[model samples]
Target: MTLTKTFNHVDYLWDDAHATSLGDDQVALFLYRSNILGADLRITNYGGGNTSCKTIEKDPLTGEEVEVMWVKGSGGDIGTLKRSGIAGLYTGRLRALKSVYGGLEDEDRMVGLFQHCIYDLDSKAPSIDTPLHGLLPFKHIDHLHPDALIAVAAAKDSEQVTKDIWGDTMGWVPWQRPGFDLGLQLERCLAENPGIRGIVLGSHGLFTWGDTSYESYINSLEVIEMASEYIEKRVAEQGDKVFGGEKVKSLSPEARKNQAAKLMPLLRGLTSSHARQVGTFQDTDKVLQFINSYDLQRLAPMGTSCPDHFLRTKIQPLVLELDPQEDLSDREVILAKLEGAFAKYREGYHQYYEKHKRANSPAERDPNPVIILYPGVGLFSFAKNKQTSRVASEFYINAINVMRGAEAITEYTSLPRQEAFDIEYWLLEEAKLQRQPKEQPLSRKVALVTGAGGGIGKAIADKLVAEGAVVVLSDINKASLEEAHATYGRDQSTYAVCDVTDMASIEGALDAAALAFGGVDIVVHSAGLAISKPLEDHTEKDWDILQNVLVKGQFQLAQASVETMRKQGTGGDFISIASKNGLVSGPNNVAYGTAKAAQQHMARLLAAELGKDHIRVNTVNPDGVIIGSKIWEGAWAEGRAKAYGITVDELPAHYAKRNLLNEIIRPEDIADGVFACVGVLTKTTGNIINVDGGMATAFVR
Candidate 1:
């Protein structure tokens, strides 16, 4: 094959002095090029690719310099790699272990050997491809799973394509599951094809090496660029006939969020054993483009874009259809269709696992699908959290792009099912799985919070996040909700603008939470207001305002949340942020106290009704929680201060000193009581926990 020698990143080059002066120059160079390679998505995405450099280090016992290969360590992304990211392994030790390997086909044993071969025992675990890098004589080696390169490598005519493009510049290693055998095959390929600049692993990815790190990195770029150019040329020659360019329609963002709200909880409930959280990628241009494509059904189930993709994405994504002819707004119709599809999908997953699993294999990975593609709506990725779902969604989009390019040149083809299974159940991945940390208290749980724009709502969201829950924030004010998302982190949390007075709004907000995260495990009804007035001065408008938010809105929220929780079959927590005013009243507080008293009673009745469904309902009756709270802002602040016969600035201290504990109650204090209700007080519900620093008059007995 034709190999281009031009270096794309000049900043990565080091002067001869720096390159040679440091005894570990090769390691330094590898780290620099790895970062450059990882920085571009076209080269590699996330932590999919790997790199290494051959160096000589003095053996502690022999006092002689021995060959050592420094490869990318596990769990360390190349984009942010440091010196510690490199695992220094002795080549001789690895080779010595190979003779005694004795054809033992156990992944755990193989992993143990890899760990034992490290030159420094304290160094990180070397990549599973250590043997492949160690066997190669080149000083620098790079292995990348670029999408463009895979388009050529995964083709049925991959051999001929390689011959046509680069001629003798690159060699091919037929598809083999990565392991000790694959590593040996690579060594053989290198020996047979002397002086080759690159090697294409059929159904896998690209590998390049050189005397220096720059040569290897440039070689990788050139080969992938060549493949990309070839694909573009073929597509232009074929015109638009190769793939269908069909227009697909999308629901409005609000409508889509509503649809997801209804269906996501169902998917979460069905796959609750495996997928803890689910997130949608319908808004992204790439995902929408794929789902809307005319040939989506034909191209979607063709399997992963590349073999390495099997690690992050499964062999084939689960595709569910939503009839574009039918109205999507009909919740019952859409949900019935989804339930049927989910059953069939689960059955298929079980069959696939039973077909491929061996006696020694690790328990089949979550039977639930990681990638779910739908026609009317875009794609949804199921994972443990929103961030992970986002990453999986990105990879699925990249796969779609690569498959489109590959199809333009020829029919897009992937590894056979058995090969996909081998990689899916590979030993290396199993070892990585073994290393994952234990789950946190709220791990895989989803929480929905109202009035999350500020005050007690934001604090509750923050506490949920701290406890490992995927929290969805909602508020009537869109700007404040956006600000809370930014403060808590956009990736970790999602937001929906909701007017609690409307049942439709409550449904949409709760649905959005279920859609963003698989299901709602905790529901915090924190949206309410107090309108102070003397009994004689109270008007109908003021009465409606107080009753609508604190009483009616709470009922609607509880109903919608219970419906979702019941469907999930997973017991959940429902917390209402009530006021101490509900239990103890003051003058000119007739309307506010009446509304809260109704709210407190409503919570109690719902708790009794939902208890059979294993749903816990409790109220966090917090008083004097004015710091950073929107409840006491503006006119309300002035009125509350006047009631205490004090200036607005002294209002907070007046309430704090009035409490038995004489302490100021911050918003976070209310949040702590909420956390205790969900986490510490699991068996305690249908009761009120006071958070007013021991308000004797309002204490629940």
Candidate 2:
């Protein structure tokens, strides 16, 4: 039937011309359909679903036409799927494996046999869900985890709801771990119920198929639209009684955000006792609504029903035990409660592992919650890196949506604990985890670099990001900051405008850092300006400006950032990009030299004072870094050149010749020195490294 019904929730993005252009290329059409379906989070979350198309292809070896199945590969995301990201397997061989299958005990062994059926050796490795798509008797199949459908699937009377919605048009299958066994069940359901268009896998997702690519795409959308309408109508009937009504009023936007910023570092620290973790905070309307509900304590503990949701968010979240309305404003009270809650959570997680773990199961993972729900505040998710953390928050939000819809009609239900434990510690899942690339040195670390729009600051920021840290590139120059921010992916870095001399401006940048990627673990003081003039020619204005930006600016930035680091309680690095001019006395550079000297000493003083908090402070000194130095682009270059009786253009060569190594220093050279202090010299603090091509005159005394 033609799909002309208007959709109220999901968008209809199918363009007839686009599909027609892809003509008869079955795999290409499959990818086109998968991309569109994955583009909307309402359809499925990132890396949560798989799709496949069966095509007739000539075998490279036999040179005869054979049925081949092309499906999304292991660890692949349909949203960004490409030709190389799919695995092509011989369809007949996959179906033939049914004869040798050794029942449920051999499910994992069955996964290993699929590789032998590879139609193309160069294709990506197949995922565990490969059999589910290959055994289905259809040309095109879509297996998606849409929240609307999952809501119905995760409800108490899911099978009855399936019958109520589509009667005999759709079938139902109970919860089963994805593998060879589940594939057989789906094939059997279709065989028994001929002419059924799709099946709702209980507490799992939706499966739909058609004879053609367009037909399959439309069929999936149609099912989701009908489910969305059903849920919306039921929610309307339920009214505000959803989640048993709000237990506490939501904090004002600003107040809630302020509270989140204050709490994120503490949470990051507490949860990171075993392994350091990056965090993401969400105060969206949906999250706020759930956290403020009376049933939050009861429903959140039941955990997420869908495997895709729990795999990222864990089985359940740790609901902070504090009355937001009363304790949010009291720091001491909140801190005391948070400590107790975290201790309790760790003990409970350990108990969960001990209760459900099998003899052959992989050892228990970190005994910490991935998702944290704060009443009257919002949600906080933590993981090994920024992207995972952010995606986990999204998955939990999806779970929240599923719970809302299910509760509006029938009671919401999560997977049984035994089933959840089996899926969680599955040997196949453990193998996948082991296959992941080793993390970079700065993984799970967040940094804030001042004056990062260009030159040394930008170079340092780039280096930190390359080593796997999410950074906030702060600069007063809007145009330059935007330019720098564009070079990195959205997840890798963000830009904030700040004047380091202003405490409020400095704090604002820290807030951006906290909101962007939890909180800062590395603070690089790289913002500065230089004034070069003879002692007699120097004006008070020159002195004030230099000291304010270079010396006082460093002090204020450190002062503001240390508070956040202290809250995290996770030892951090404070690297000051000071200068050789601080140690060396030079002519016509009185104001700049004095400011640099003060900056160096301030770092030392702070290093001594903040040592108890495990905050290491250090400095990198670079001399005559003319190439790509912002300070050298202005009058400072000409003034220093004139003092040395050389032209501005000749200063770089002149400085190179003056150094002991006779090497011209670049911005990248200074960046290497900073990385050494943060990434390499972890145990050594309150020290200075020189990136000045070995200048004897500037040697530390």
Candidate 3:
């Protein structure tokens, strides 16, 4: 979690031979490779990585030597990279080769390759993965699919993971296909972050760079190593057995590679009947157990992970008996299980087609298991022509680990069969739709309610909840916040023990709220205390405290909330708990009335400036509110007792009678009005509705 500069490390190996072509670009090339191998940030994990650099020059045949690039060839360990580690290629030629979609002969492609690479042959063959790196516009680029970084990225809360690790500094991209798609996607990312120095790819890896090679390299290492340490802590917590193991048995990479070839197509055939099934997990024990399951093997009808995973792992595993009698050849068991699995898998596929696929593209392939046998050990995922399978294989591994863990816990509680189908196949809520919820009217909305410890702000929060807005409540009273969110309620709120006078504390509250809620959208400035001191005897500090709660506190909250809301694009709403003092400066309340007046205009100015962003700033100035609110019970009782030299009981009717309505407004009623301004009124901003008993009716229309 603690990521910073200043760490010792092994130096990157850079051979000079690969850099011989560029008389001037030599430093750029060296920096590109050195940064990759030296930093934890660039490589991601120990070796899951990527690399690129800009090329300049034209071929000598045309007497042109403008620019050409040499990227790290695929499958080469970047850590040991030297100047010779790079693979040279002509920029224009490589760009053109990417678009070639012909059954071009090997000899012709070889000739094209030689012509495409404008370099001394000493640089060696270009890396297979260079196409993507070469496609980017930057002078230098690198990628790393690291183990520690991916551990968190692969989890369900990868977004939060990145936030926790990188603070608000790193860019986040959700899981997506790599290669051409990733390159294009990141180009736009770089555009958004014009001088972006690093990228934390969700469910993938991190990328780091600088104007200078050393800067990029150091930053990347600092970031990755920091994240790696964090992940190590997490894996230790989850139990390291879940992360890595030296003794645990695994299918040899070669055996896995071979079995996946046979299994991929077979499983794909079975699960493809409906477009949702993916193949099984890779752990042999779980695969065997699942195959050996009395119920699953007997009745497997549909598929898993997601549809794309279906392409990754195939549809079904091969199936057969572990102990067959007379015909007992190892090969026979494999064949028989495979055959049995295919036939039933086909039947299941057809049934799925009947149930789900009424009219899609005509079913393109037959249903069958790619690999099946007694105690069925599933082959890992792979594609036939593609270099490798990534996501599905990860899925299989994670699933197997989870399944093995769960075997001790009785049963896994996935969604019921019908629910899974609904989620996977629903027309309106499938992957794309579900990935991004339709942005709501208050999509980028947030609110901060002061005095939320008791009544009005709490009521406002209740209403904001209905409108899908998150609220942060602040108060001078810490105990009140705790009591409000007691042991048995829906604890969906955050509280700040803020003293309005202190800038540091107020700023802290605002920052905490933003951090907790992602950002601030609407601020219900409700944290104020009431007092009624006759002007002659009013002391400066007494006046200051009241002003601090009612006026200064609001200013601080708005300042913090506005900054965040602006960045979030939600615009923002600032509503203050202004009394009727601004409209009718009441008796004996000199400091309170003056502060209230300032509070009203503060909102007006904020609204005028922020209105350009569609952020409507507003206020709800209320009077004579009763009920459980702290303002009514505590401050109102004490203030009224001092005002008239009378007890609390007489003050309720005394104040209520002065109003035209002759009825006291409940805290809930005032809360309702405030909520309406924030949630319901899309057009009205900078307006105040009075709630007195018509006491100040001179200007009342």
Candidate 4:
């Protein structure tokens, strides 16, 4: 197995899981590692496996340090997590308690269990594993049942097979409900194998750790990749069908095109877009098998790679049957069999819940059997969208292939279903839902962001679109506008050219955008110019240019888009792109800094005036972001680089060192911040989010 791989990778593996939690760092990692631990498990999605991080910080109420741990929050997928995504927990008291043995028997007592660890009393509850993570000795841990790893571990000779591959670097324990018992077993395993780099829970998942988050994250990816490689080799020698599902037979490009047209209309109502998309994959045995599992329940518990697959794939797949191939005479008989199978599965599911569930009511989700397999023909996964279907199919197919391989050693078995129900109905995992907001978050909104050429603007635009609103890209650069149009343009997206700082330019863009894609919903005035210069070398001309480009430019777009958005009768969203220089000032920015700061306050005042109209206004102040923009390249373009007293390479470094992330911030990152303002944070008013990657933290310190 390759020992190392570069980072910069992310994904959602929870697309298959129905059981998930928002708990302590260790617990979060525990769940994540379960997927990574074995070949039978896998986490893949736009929202994949769930994970959390934990640490101790000062309690806002007491102004004293508390044992706070951050677990992955409910909605944000593991592949794309930030600090806030994790739920906070108090470890001190959690450590003091052992089990639910004799505490207040009711759930309310358990709720108050960690009251002492809260940073904010009004904040979200700690993850379900607060007690588990608190009890564990490892400072940082992870739990995942990576599909690749699960495929291997789900076999009868799993332990011996793992030993042959990993040698003494790993530990294996039988799967148990993820609670006091699992935590206790893991503790014992660590005690036995002090040098354990990671652990694999039989019929469950994997665990990997390090002294720090990056170290642990990197290691987790490595070990998981290794396991995936092993799964690939084994499956290659043994299986058929992939995410593209078992291809009936390859068709010529012309024939395939026609087939795609027919399939498009049939699958259109499954997702947001009705238009069929054409994609092809080959040779990736994992993806193929991952796409072809007909009976995930019979193969292995492939509902989710982890516990959080419920949000993405719902509960399960639509399972159908196969029959006499080409036997058109038996079509009626096949339909009767299909109907009977669904009834059996649904009745069985109800019985499973009634047998073990002792807590909260379960969501009355769809149970139309997401998996459609014709026994001899192939399997298909049903979903509201094709992407979800593809992801589910991939995970299911891979797990089944691995399970088939396991049959070579002994009788195939699955983890206890009753226990799965407990987790599927976990109370701690249910808290995130209890705290959800009352609105649809992005309820009444539409937005248009200018200069969505890439980077911050693009990130913000993506965020807006993701939150269920339409977006229009306004840019003077035709090439940039087209790039965005091609990249993000869909039914909800539009593109137009309008150089900010010019009225006609702004008006034309406004008209084209509104006419083609309904009307403006919100306005993110992100189009601006950034020119860094020292005060001594700066001139009046520089000052005017900076003010006109950065300040006047945003005002022009907000002026026009705001009126159109307001006409929607749902008010409007007006946001401006500002800089940290406006909040605390920056070094040598001079004119650029001055104008950026003015732009921020301008938005603040605008918010107050527009409050009467129900229009929300805000500004984004991101730092030194190189988001596919000329300004980024020009920031260190030549003589200026020399004047900064460093090589051109050192310029970005010097700037980046000033931020907390210690990395160059990208423009898309900033755009995401802007999108959150209009999208998720619609109730927020007059806010300024610093997308400076921690530069603002330096200023705070």
The prediction achieving the highest lDDT against the true structure is 2
lDDT of 4: 0.57
- lDDT tens digits, residue span 652-672, model 4: 777688677788877667767
Question: lDDT by residue for model 3 over 380-468, one digit each (tens)?
Answer: 33222111223345444433333323222222222233433333343322323345445444332446777777777777766665555
Model 1, 20: alpha-carbon shift in Å? 15
Give per-residue CA lDDT, model 2, range 442-516, as digits (tens): 999999999899999999999999999999999999999999999998689988999998999999899888878
User: CA lDDT of each candidate?
Assistant: 0.78, 0.91, 0.54, 0.57
Candidate 1 residue spans exceeding 4 A from truth: 1-29, 55-67, 95-98, 101-108, 210-214, 243-262, 273-275, 283-302, 328-333, 502-508, 531-542, 559-571, 633-638, 645-662
**Regions more than 4 Å wrong, model 2:** 1-6, 325-333
- Cα TM-score of candidate 1: 0.87
List candidate 3 segments past 4 Å from native: 1-425, 428-445, 466-468, 487-491, 634-647, 696-701
| Rank list by lDDT | 2, 1, 4, 3
Model 3: what TM-score? 0.42
- The number of the candidate with the highest TM-score is 2
